[model samples]
Each structure stands twice: as structure tokens, then as C-alpha cells.
Target: MKAAGFGYHRPETMAELLTLLADLPDARIIAGGQSLMPMMNFRVAMPQHLVDIEKIDGLDSINLRDGTLQIGAMVRQADALASPVIKKNCPVLADAIAYIGHQQTRNRGTVGGSLCHLDPASEIPLVCALLDAQLYIASRRGTRMMNFRDFADAPLTTSLAEDEILTRIDLPICDPDTRHGFGEYARRSGDFAVVAVATHLRFAGETITEARMAFAGLGAIQARADRLEMFATSQKLSPALIDKLAQEAAQMPAESDLHHDADYKRHLAACLLREVLERILRHG
Candidate 1:
């Protein structure tokens, strides 16, 4: 169905967008609109005004500063996936984006849009949690940075005030010892994942120094598998240890949906986590 009556304004600059957002507190910020358009079509969101930021200049660049990679809010997913900086600094992010929708959707979807949209089954959130990415936000008051873990409140919900616009995402550069892997199970190539896992392992010589694991498509918010991570890090990086961690991760709380029951999702999570851990351990 066509979107209910709404007004649209395409801002040419960040300042202009901020002013418009301040004036129209309830207005929805549209960047790429890949996720928003579907919600609008389904009548899940009926904003009175849409502040389109696609034409706003300079919000589509990717830069490396100091030891962090900064990606502008409007950077397309396809561009991000092809970015050498992203590949070198945050390969897990590149891997996660590779699993997002199709080429067309990736061309039209923005990194900021995906993070702000906060779909529980999406890859962006899981990447954020795994990398401990930071989100930059701008409002009439000033700019503030939020940890990804705190920025996302629930599925499709964020802590962003209505007047705040996500400006960029800041990801730490991957250390030489850092090893990462991403895994997901979807019914089809372009479908949302039934269960997804992103794993980051830091190896010191041979023993596991650190392990960070995040999960999607199972909780209201993308979450870190803390118990699993702790267990995996405390043990040797072996197939048996990975299997035990996967079993523990599978026991974590999971939401049930019509497509899959909680028990089934738990099993999938365990299997995928083990697969991802094994791949990273073997390759790195």
C-alpha cells in the first residue's frame, strides 16, 4: 500500500538537516530508505514528515583516523563492502555486510540506516556488538557518541532522540593478532538470517587470549554470548572446546517465531557458533 500522507524535504547539508529535524521533532530521517520504505509500505511507520538526507553532501565517505575507521552515516552498504579500509581494519564488518540482502538492496541501504533501524535479524547489529563499534549522533544540542551495546534498545528501537541524526560509525582497527569470522543461516540467498554469529578471536602464540562472540536473529537486541565467550577464552582453541561453547551459547535465551521455535534456534546458534569459531581458528 502507498504510504499514508507525508511531507518530504531533502536537505543539502548537515546543518540544514539538523534545523529541519529540530523544527519537525517527529519527522523521520530517511537515508537510502531501504528499511524504512518497507515499514512504511506495511503501515508500521507513518511519519508526517520525512527528512531525506541522501542529498546531504559529505555523508558518504569512509576515512581512517588514528587507529579507527570512521564511516559516514550515508555510506552505502555496497561501497562499504568494497572498501579496502573496511576490509583491512574491520574484516568482520565487511563479512557481515556481505550477508545483507541482495546487490540492489545493498546499493540502496546505508550503514547508519541499518544500525538505526535495529532489525533483530540483521547483520549490522551483530557486527556492532562484536566489534564494540561506537555510533556518533548529532542534534540541536550537540554531538554525542554512544556504544553500540547501549545505542540499541530493542528490535527496531534505538536510544537516539527523535531530533538526533546518526552521523557516523567508529570501528577500531583490527590488531595483527585479531582473527574474525562471520556465519549465518538463511532460507535463501537474500533472506534474513534464521541465526547469525560473528566471532572475534585474539590469539597469543597458541592459547586463546580473548574471544568476543555476538549473536543475531535470536533476541530482541543483538547480544554478546558472554557465557560462551568466557568459556571459549578459558580453554584451548580446539574443536572439542568450540563444541562445548556452542552448546552453552545454544542454551541462552532465544525468542520463538512462526518460522522457527526457540529450541530449533538454540540448536542452530550452537552449530553456527562452532562453525564460525572453527573457521577462524583454522584460518588465523
Candidate 2:
């Protein structure tokens, strides 16, 4: 398939990009071009105008400041996976990205683009939601920030307005005492996860203090069961507690496709939760 012909505009400045976006209400912004290009090639998306922002100034910085990992919209996944700041502050994110496509794909994939694509099986949004990261969106009018929970509305959909562009993603620096781990079941190393789980655990001596869990490939969007996480914090990771967690996860609503049944997805969720929890307990 070939993409429909479209007008292309490259904006070297953020103001120019925003202005172009505001002017061309139906234009699609291309940053990394990894996600959008493929869809365009398939003719799934055929915007009349393309506002390329790869040359925009001040949009690809990866830095840690004031207890947050500030990643610009254009920061490539490969670079992010290699950042010392990310490795130390949010290793779980780095781990999750390892499962996204291959090095070539990650080399061209942008954090903002991936999150905005909002694929139910994508790793970036799941990590953002699990870690309670903040998203920064901008437009010619003004800028505003929101947490990932509000940023992601549904699969392949977000709260971003037509004229707005995601500018940056702020990931909270992990607590020194918090242990992070991520696990997923995929057909291949670089394939979308069949079912994935990201978890952060805090322990008071040998007892668990706090726990955070988020899932992918289980619902309309990546989700967290606050009740389940809070319940995990209710007791140590004993065999009984692990069984309880799995049972709770088995009840989470999950959609089914032609390849997998709803019951199968739910079973995978329990399996992933059990695997990740045991890993954290053994290593942390």
C-alpha cells in the first residue's frame, strides 16, 4: 500500500510547528515517524498535511531534574534505553522498552509518538501509567500538563486536541527503597506482549509496604487495579498472598480477539502477576 499524496512542512522551531498545527487543523505531526509512517503507508491515516517536527529545537533532551526524568518528545527509544539517568531512576521503563520491536524500531521511535499512538499492546504508555508519569502538551494557544492516567483515554486514542502536540513526558524518580520489575509474555523478543505487567514494590523490612501494578493487552487501555495493589501491600509475598493476587487478577475484565479468548487473556494476566511478584520477592 502507498500513502496518499500530502503536503509536507518541516518546522525548525516550536513556535513554527505550533502555528502550522493550528493553521492546518487536519494536519498530522510527524516526530519519529515510526508509528505514523507505517499507518500512512497502509493508508490507515491520510492527513492532507504533515507537519514534521524532527527539526524543532529543544525537543529531544533527556535529563533528570528535581526528582523527575524529563524526556523530550523527540527522544528516541534507543537513546532512552541507554540513558544512565533512566537506568538508575526508572529501570523498569528501560526493561519494558526492551520488548518493543527491535533496535531499528526503537532507534526511530519517539517517546511522545509511542505514547500518543496509545496502542493497547505498547510498552511506553503502560510504563507511564504504571509510574504515574506526567505528560506535557503544547499548542499555539498555551500549554498544560496532565498525568498519564488522564493523558491516555483509549486504545489508539488520547486526550490530545487536534491542534496540540505532546511536548514532553515527566517520569517520577523512583524511591531509593522501591524495587521495580517488569515481565511480559510475547511470541518473540521484539513482539508486542500477549500480556505484560510492570510493578513497583516497597518493603518495610521483610513485609511489603506499598505496591503498584499496571497491565497491558488486557483492556481498552493499560490499567491499574488500585485495590489489588493495595491488597498486596496488606501482606508479605507468601504463597497464600501470591495466590490471592493471582485470583484477583483473574477477575479483571479483558477483551478477546480472534487469536485469544477472554479467559485466556485473564489467565495470562494472573500468570504475569505471579511471575513478576515472585521475581521481586526473590531479588528485592
Clashing pairs in 2: none
lDDT of 1 by residue, 1-284 (tens): 77887999998988898999999856999898999998898889999999999888888999999899999989999999999989998999999999999999999999999999999999988999988999999988999999998899978999998889999999888899888899999999979999999988888886788889999988888989888888878567888898788779779899999889999999999889888888877876
The Cα error of candidate 1 at residue 6, in Å, is: 0.8
Candidate 2 yields a Cα-based lDDT of: 0.88
Alpha-carbon RMSD to native, per candidate: 1.1, 1.1
Candidate 1 wrongly placed segments (more than 4 Å)? none
Q: Which candidate number has the best lDDT?
A: 1
Task: Go through the candidates in order and give the clash count of each.
Answer: 0, 0
Candidate 2 per-residue C-alpha lDDT over 1-284 given as tens digits, one digit per residue, 9 for 90 to 100: 78899999999888888889889858998878888998999999999999888888888998889988999989899998998888888899899988888999999998888998999988998899898889999999899999998888888999989999999999988877788878888888888888898988887776779888999998888887787898888477777888999999999888997687889988999999999888877776
| lDDT on C-alpha atoms for all candidate structures | 0.90, 0.88
